[model samples]
Target chain A: MSGLTLIASYPKSGNTWLRAFLASHLRDGRPIDLNADLSEVPNLTSRSLQDCHAGLEHSDLSRQEVALLRPLTSRRIAREQPGFYKTHDSNLVPPGAREPAIPPDAIDRVVCIVRDPRDVAVSAAAHFGWSLDDSVDRMADTAFCIGHSPRRLNANVEQWISSWSAHVESWLDAGGVQLLMLRYEDLLADPLESFTQLCRFLDLDDTRHAVSRSLEESRFSALAGQEARGGFRERSRTSTAPFFRAGKAGEWRTALPAVLAERVVGTHSRVMARVGYG
Target chain B: MTDGLLCGWRIRSDIALPELLDWQGDDRIPDLVVRLGEVDERLPEGREISPLLQIDGTGAGLLQVPMVGRFLVRPSGGITIAPQPEASEAEIRLFLLGSVLGMVCHQRALLPLHASSVAIDGGAVAFCGPSGMGKSTLALRFAQHGHSVVSDDICVIETCEPPRVRPCFPRLKLWRDTMEDAALSPEGLERNRRGQEKFHFRAPHAGVREPLPLRAIFLLRRAGSGEGEGIQRLAAPLDIMAALEAETFRLQVGHALGRAETLFQARALIANDVPVYRLTRRADAQPDRWLDAIAATIRG
Candidate 1:
């Protein structure tokens, strides 16, 4: 059986933070280079991986064709070894495609990290350089997507995030793969507990000391310091804001406008209630 | 050997490649022979091979291209194409234009760059990058600005005393978005294939049949926030070599075919003779703006 575990999330959720934690924990006290060390958890939708399987460039394929072939390509990638992949795409099957974005049988485990849609809106707005209202509206849209750049091919796959509620519901209801859900607020409130639980889910050593050490190393300050010293490669080339901007969970109260927050919450009220965000 | 000119080579093919402009009317002796025949699923055991291609000890190799066909290329400049039974004429035509032609160039010891070029001031300037980096789109912009397109996708370079680039087909494949951006209706243009939204636009002017002296090579890269859109000359030899290596079509396949030394020699020769520049553009930058900038750099 293949050993493919996914660190799945919506955009601007705590996906990167979780990766940082896992990377630091796995390194066992070695200094973590946010850019270099994080290579272990590669993007699931990497163009290079797809190109290797397709025997042609991803740019040669239309978006629909790419989506259709992603499952097979991902399965091939997973066959190589046990590895973790980061994905922001929802679990929904692409329109007119039979299978979901991440094929069920290809993945062994999925660790889904979710943040409040309001907070996600604020962070997404900053990360993508969209206005707060625009970001909120996108979060409410059922066809919301990222990495649909018109001028150039994106390194990552076109993620179909849909709406905030739909994105969360799809993953939660996803079949076949083992699911372990984690909330950003819980991680912020108690990193040691949350990450230790995550470690256990991933079948890694969850010793208290290891968890504490990884938490210390992957602290927002550490990641921000590294980005400050040498810029983050994953940062959007267009965005002026730092990739690790404002890692606080509830900053949306002050950062996101009241109307935008209400819009996100209203749009995602049912899922928000289910996830304890309501 | 049969007789015809293909990418400046006199060749004969059993399968009629109508996409290639008929350069010979069965008169001249051929430098290469291409026939349709059975190709093995895999190369003979213990041979050097890429995932998609393989080369025997004698430089004969097989290319297993998806959807189009399996091709066996011989060291003696002969080729055998075993197209999939269901493959359409369009599919075979496209593969012949791209990968098959590229492999033939590699077998012939020519450098087939993953680039598109246009004739500027009697010389060919090329835009090179991975697919979807706007190489053809930029070349179309150049053609629209009245420059003659030297090649559409693969720019075949013969590394001589001064390397020269031979033209391929005179068609530019543009995505629907790019066509709309250029304000051209996609009404009559041929889609790259039936289902794909990419359309092939024939250049208004014919592709240059004669090889032109190579002038400048620009490696297309996405601009960072700190870097503005423009052309920056690559002064370092290593950088020039790196750029050339990055854009060489089927480089891994070339290595598998035991042509690594030949490819290296070609890269060195071209790097020494040509001025390589890095053309950086923002994702949303206007094509005309950067086209003008690239033209100015090439003219200089």
Candidate 2:
């Protein structure tokens, strides 16, 4: 039995933040270097791993081929060592495939971090260089996905991000792996309690001092400063905004236009209420 | 089975690999052989050579390639392939040309580099990198700019005095995006495989049959933030060695075949014989600008 913990989330969520916090806490309250230590939590859909396993370039693979082989490849990698991997893909089985994108047996536990859709729209708009209306439309579209660029290779595989409601619901009902749901808002509002629960879920040492220090060290302000100095590698090429932009949760109230906010709520209100975002 | 000359070696294979340029029929003994035979899904008990390759003994190893097939390279210069049940012949042939052929080169003690080359002013200029780094795309851009294509994927380097690169084939495999960017249509071209958007465009001019003297090698890299787009000469011996080693095709298999000495010799021969440079370009930079820069540098 391999031990693999997944830090799964939708795009523009707090997946990277969670990874940074985990990396800092794991290193015993060491100050996190955004570039150096970020590799501690590698992305599940790394291009090198996929190319090595598939014995061909990822661009040569069809979308379904990439989807079908991704889980098997990750399973093979997980067998080598136990570690955390971040993914933005939804938990869904491809056409004619028996397993979802992430094999259940390969993962022992999953920490799914979800953010408010309104905030996600605002951040995604900046992150992808899309207008606010377009971002909201993408969030509401059931077939929305990332990494469809035809110009160059994307670091991650083609991720199927269903509508925000469906995305949250699928992970909640994902079977086999033990699931621990965390809200990005809770992480911002109460860092100690939220990260404490997270550490407990992963069976890490949740001492108060370590958790408090890690929370302070991985604060958004600190990460933003690091990005300003060295620049974040994960920032999209088209995006002009920095990677760690506006980590506050409720800024969407001011950032997102009224019509777009209503649309996000109208489409994702059920999941929002279920996750207490409403 | 068909007979063809690939990288100056006569090859007979059970399947027709369209990527390799055709050679005149001959009675000379084949330097390599590829045939269909049963192969185990996993390699037999042996030392793990590379992540995807394993060797049980000298000159005998198994290559388990995902989605394409399994290959067993025997000491007798023959390769046995067991393709995946669902893979098409087109897909199988592509992998055979890229990875399988590279492994064969290693078994035969030849150095195969992961690169694409274009014949520039009667000399070879090679671009080496991992896949999807636009190696083939850059080569095609050179060909479109009237430079002759030398190779598409694997550049075979012979370790003779003043090492030379033998042209592999005349086709450039391109994704749909690249074809569209170049304003070429994929409507009539053969796709690499069914459902894959990649198409193979045969070079408009015939490839140079005679080996070209190695001129210079440029390692392609995407420009990082705040980094300028241009060619920087790699002068340090260690840096040049690292760049060459990173581009060695099926490097783990080469080590397992007890060719480490030969591989190191080839790297040294190339590093010392040719000037190596790192060409960094913006991801969105116009291809012509960088291509012109590379041509200007080579001409000077």
Tell me the deviation in Å of residue B14 in model 1: 6.7
Among all candidates shown, the one with the greatest TM-score: 2
**Model 2, position A74: C-alpha lDDT score:** 66
Candidate 2, residue B74: Cα displacement in angstroms equals: 4.0
- TM-score of every model versus the real structure: 0.73, 0.83
In model 1, how large is the Cα lDDT of residue B200?
74
Instruction: Please provide, for model 1 over A1-278, each residue's C-alpha lDDT reduced to its tens digit, 9 standing for 90 to 100.
Output: 35679999988899999888888887884568887788778777766555655445655545665666666666666776458888987899877556876788778899998899899988888888888888888888888877666544566667677888898888898888899999999999988889999999988879998888888888999999888887787887667589999899899889987887888877889999999997
Positional deviation of residue B111's Cα in model 2 after best superposition, in angstroms:
2.3
- Over B19-42, each residue of candidate 2 has an lDDT whose tens digit, in order, gives 676666467888778889899866
lDDT of each: 0.79, 0.81
Task: Give the C-alpha interface root-mean-square deviation per candidate.
Answer: 4.8, 3.9
User: Candidate 2 overall Cα lDDT vs. reference?
Assistant: 0.81
